[model samples]
Target: MTASDARRPVQLEIAVQDAAGARIAFEAGADRVELCQALAETGGLTPSAGAVEAVLAVAGRAERLAVLVRPRPGGYVYDADEIAVVAADVREVVRRGAGAVVVGALDAAGGIDTEALSRWIDAAAGAEVVFHRAIDTLSAPVDAIDQLVALGIRRVLTSGGATRSIDGLGTVEALVRGSAGRVQIMPGGGVRVEDVPAFVSSGADAVHLSARRSSGDTAPSGPGGGASGFDVTDGAIVAAARAALDEATSGS
Candidate 1:
């Protein structure tokens, strides 16, 4: 067979949070993992030394670990202090050997701050860049895509700026076409085991989601527990997502 036939497609990366979660996903066959803290908060950034170290220990097996680089969950725009924090964060994460960096910045009208983003991408020093769902906040996603392309971002994680990807298929498809090999379009948000097919059918270059199971039908004890908007990820969910990926790849 030709070398091209042996080569796989770009990547099938899954967003994940912890070392245990990463191990489960890697074992279940996820190609890569995005390390973050408050996945409930749309997968906010975590630059903790211990967490980064934990993730790095598994870097040998994981396809990659792209750490989310936001200082807060409120918005993409950042004050001077937050920017400094993110700057320092880039240095530390790269020093810790993260495989990629997921981040973004936007103006009040929701347009991407190409300058701010470019600065971070440079600060990241050649590590892959995944513009997070902040793309969802933009008033005109197409415009944002064009802007990001000019900035030379690696990929964008978005659900077509909607509540979930299924609701934004048309726009997502348009984005995939608009990207036209310039960058990757990774769909995310509200993606579950059963809904993965819908994302595949929509022409996503790749998919992203939080996959996990509850301890029980019973809820958690309180706010510090499951009541939080972003529940922690689980190995079972990662396995299911892998199964879905296998089905999608095999055309089942």
Candidate 2:
């Protein structure tokens, strides 16, 4: 571990889909909120301008807001026209008051699409940038992390190229050691409240989780099954995760 890792405070970043979930996450002690839409359908699609505005309205002074800039749901790879769309979305989110933006892209070679990523970062207008989990799709995540750092990305949300952080703890640890404070390695993907302490102990500077639970209500049959009743952020789960992180960091 680097000397700085000993002093870095652990952060909890929550993913929320709408104004209601954003408010819940903030109130429950989330340090940052990743705002997106269609999380249930799309892994997380770019929220509308109005949704971004609403989330910003509810964000606390100390809370950081990051909007997801994915133009589509199928893949991280995008063409020139799609890159243009992502650039425009970055501008819109920053102008609407997001403090950061989460984005990612891949080349046909299954590597970081530096050209596309650069354009999105440029369009952020100085907002903090986070390379999203698409990094997991790369053949070499450790190398990709270095490239992202060279690009001035502040953080990268990943699960160590696995389906879950816990399943890839070794890779996550290597990333932490490899980073040596150059970039923040945030463990995400199926990170549960029970997993916070282990993630903290594993050298994650911060952790990202949705803390989501289904509403348990079924919608009538319709297009896309009438929206699947949507999953919302669970404030209690967020609170528990925060407490766990505090305990782990304090003890360390």
Q: Quick one: best TM-score, which candidate?
A: 2
TM-score computed on alpha carbons, candidate 2 = 0.93
* Residues 1-252, model 2: lDDT tens digits: 345445459999999998899889988999988999888777899999998888888885413788999988998889999999999999988987899899999998888999998898899988889999998887778877678888989988898888887898888888888888899889999888888877887888899999999987786657654654669999999999988887777765
- Each candidate: RMSD: 4.0, 2.1
Deviation in Å, model 2, residue 161 alpha carbon: 1.0
Cα displacement (angstroms), candidate 1, residue 214, comes to 3.6
lDDT of each: 0.73, 0.86
The clash count for each model shown is 1, 0
For candidate 2, list the clashing residue pairs, or say none: none
Q: For model 1, how does the per-residue alpha-carbon lDDT over 128-209 read when each residue is reduced to its tens digit? A: 7888888887766866677788887989898887887778877887888788778888888777777666666555667787
Q: Give the deviation of candidate 2 from the true structure as CA RMSD.
A: 2.1
